[model samples]
Target: MRKKKCTMSIPTIIECFQMGMTSNEIALQANVTARYINSVLQQHNVERQPHSSWLRRYTVNENYFKTWSASMAYVLGFFAADGCLPKDLQLVSFSQKDPKILEDIREELQSTHPIKTNPRTGVHLLNISSKIMKEDLMKLHGMSPKKSTILEFPYVPEEYLSHFVRGFFDGDGNINYKKRTVSFVGGSQTFMEHLKKRLERYSFEPFIVSKEKYHRLFLSGRKTVYHFGQWIYKDKNLYIERKHLEFNREKLPPDQIKDRPFKAHKSAIEARKLKLLYYYNLYRDFPEACKSANIGINTFYRWISTDEEFQLKFNSICNEKKI
Candidate 1:
């Protein structure tokens, strides 16, 4: 009698082959002959990679965090801001809105793990599952699960400290054009204080302010912000593209830039007041408008009371809405 053909799915066979399983191993799982497994892979245009290539595919430099190179420092800082390590898993994961930084980080870590995207949020994530890597991050770097509120700044060597700060900035910082400010937000008050102290060492007058849920380190004024840009990006190898472009725009002449006046800080405040007023007009609700404008309601009322122009504009908006 003729032998019945194997009923295993072709995709499953191909998956096994792609996962570096030998034909015999796949055959054993699929209950088919080794030749049948090979036939399915061949039919699906799956060429066999050498064993060495397979080894390289799944392996990463587990000791990558042990040294203090610029790349390592930057990655560590970025991880401190955007990465996560679960207490129960041997996994370290990073999520970013920009996938390019994630790709750079993967190369820096010598990891071949796939970068996956969340369909719902369009955020890219890279997960590396290695016990050694996770432990190294915890023991050497003081990173812990649920570290957002209590994380302490890690000990970065003096030479690579700028790179580390730049990495953290790329992850949790903002460059405001209208305000001509560079600000960093962190969940840990102590962490923000540490960062503020470091900035002071460079003669920068960074100050910390408490927000509702976090702390902010602010470096305002065009000259100060520009100097900060220079300091962080002096020897940069990796950075978020959009933020880099934003800082580069500061190089333009004062007349060419429309965001802020060259020497008048009042223009920036006026611009912010006008923006908040505009948001209020659109929403017709003070709290909602404040939320949209990312300002506190107390600040809004202060602006209304202190700035006659802003108060008049707000009154006009409210009157129009009443009509």
Candidate 2:
């Protein structure tokens, strides 16, 4: 009881974690710092996991994903270093004994590689697999599942599954995600139903944005977007690429073999599509909107000023007539 008074609140710590908040992320979100975040966690005896250091590290799962879900508390990996996908993506069961479906899965994997005919998995991975399937994705991803650290938000609603964020991340132009998640709303059953229904059917990738933005922007609270091609999901429920996990050349389960095989990142992936979607729909203007949204103008400028794509995205949204 006495400990609670001297240190930060437990909800505050946990909420940050659930939101896919890293030490740097938490500092920025909660108006603190990396050291301070560790200090607080220490006070509470909360341990720091690999995904704990945001904007600084990147890696992925070892075995198949275990109870992976696209939501809070789930950790994802980003491309910290410039590297090609693992060889497994390229190593299809070319042998005669290979199952046709598994061969096709391997063939599909081959094309997504950045290198020609050299199939590498990808820069990141997400543990969306739950129970058995998750195990598969993790095995494919090559890392441990990020533990449910802590998530705390006093006012975010539960129904809205997704949205967008403009200038709330880091300086390099990348941003973290905080969506409603597949599990939180209905867990794997509902998530699988929706995921299966939408595969290849839509043109846009369903992106995960800031939960706080949805509450203020869309009145109806319909959070989630259906996107395709260049735009992809990140943040809590996604993975970029990971480290320290092992991979054993194995075959995909017969059931999953026929399912839409997860493909690697597309060639020339850019922020253009995401920007268009954001500005045309979810983007709010500067200054007043920034203040109200709790986003600083400095942040807004930092992102747009340095990145050409970001500027183009913003300018196109605002209808710049050109100077």
Candidate 3:
């Protein structure tokens, strides 16, 4: 007697993700542990199929994109209103998802005229920046930020900006260049300020909002008058852009890039952790790729072990895709 094979389908997992269903939900309905579901889905290559059909068939809610803003992508809406970039907000597209924050940003765009909007989704999102100063903006750019809103910070500092750039604003070429040198090229102090004020709806951290101004006054040598970013003199054309950063070990946060702890299988997840450490250091380690995942490193490994599905899914991305 041949029993039926309960092979998990890619569309099913994607449907669950699209319907904004959590791992637990998917696990329950699929009659498989969420971890196993993630594992199978990861193995299935939906991308190998036509994207348009895949998306149309999947039909995810537009607002569902906001989940990318949360650490673990609050499937249960634990931090819906507060969906700014979490420590682990990596692994998802951040800049592309910036538009999702527009509904949350509407309060700040108080212009009498029709508020400007981006072409792709018609959502007017602020350009990401770290050097802009809040007070300097109101005085310089003629912007009128809403004083009453709880999301008061109008800027993201250099350190915080790095996280988004590397994690979210990613680019091609294996290594995430956008995140590595995450920075803006133009803007007045005021422009940066207004931009900051609007991004509060997203998960951008406020304390990590202003660094250029503080550095100018105390750390740097030049007399940089601008508050938010640097004052550049290119071809005698005086303008400003946010400064780029180095990839030195000291430059990165003391720990590995923080974000929500993703779950996966013990063996597969461990393999990934080892790979992550290897890649992170291999750039300079000049050593061969290590074999085992770092056990004590990220706590998320346990979650991955328990959830078979996530382990499967993360495996697709956990390896040396960039390398």
Best candidate per lDDT, number? 1
Give the 10-residue window scoring lowest on summed lDDT in candidate 2: 163-172
Instruction: Give the per-residue lDDT of model 2 (tens digit) for 1-323.
Output: 33433234556666455334566755665555677777777778765666543312322222222333332112211110111122212111111111232223223232221111212532222211123333343354332222111111211122212211110110011221222111111112322233323432432233322222121111110122212101233332222222101111114343342212112222112222242334333445455545444445665666577778767756765774343
In order, the Cα lDDT scores of the candidates are: 0.79, 0.30, 0.31
- Estimated TM-score per prediction? 0.65, 0.19, 0.20
Winner on TM-score between 1 and 2 is: 1
Clashes per model (N, Cα, C within 3 A): 0, 39, 32
Candidates sorted by TM-score, best first: 1, 3, 2
- What TM-score, to 2 decimals, does candidate 2 have? 0.19
Q: By TM-score, who's the top model here?
A: 1
lDDT of 3 at 10: 60
